[model samples]
Target: MAKWGEGDPRWIVEERADATNVNNWHWTERDATNWSSEKLKELLMGLWVEGEEGKCEITEVSKVE
Candidate 1:
């Protein structure tokens, strides 16, 4: 662990008027729900499976939530 007032330089965030995450020490969140849903629907919509007896196909993706 780093001592008080003597933290590693790479882990320090520079002082600025806007306290942005320059060093990226703080966690950030991004909303990719819609994008992930759409990507899943696209990838799963036309998937198909075949067996010795029968075959199956995914014609539509109704919901991906």
Candidate 2:
């Protein structure tokens, strides 16, 4: 696996007052879903489980539909 922070700079989201929400977030590419599987996994490295009781890392992800 590749190291973290070793991808395109355009994917990086720097802090900005106006870009606080998802709607105003800046991006170099328009298609946000064009990321690779590895990139997607890396982006979601550490995450708490939703609709659960305790805190935990998200080991897997699946589509509901």
Cα deviation in Å at residue 50, candidate 1?
A: 0.2
lDDT of 2 by residue, 1-65 (tens): 33576766766555578656566444454554535655777767676675557677876755321
Task: Provide the lowest-lDDT 10-residue window in model 2.
Answer: 25-34
lDDT of 1 by residue, 1-65 (tens): 76677888786455678877654568676899999999998898879999998989999888877
User: Of the candidates shown, which would achieve the greatest lDDT relative to the real structure?
Assistant: 1
Candidate with maximal TM-score: 1
The TM-scores, one per candidate, come to 0.58, 0.26
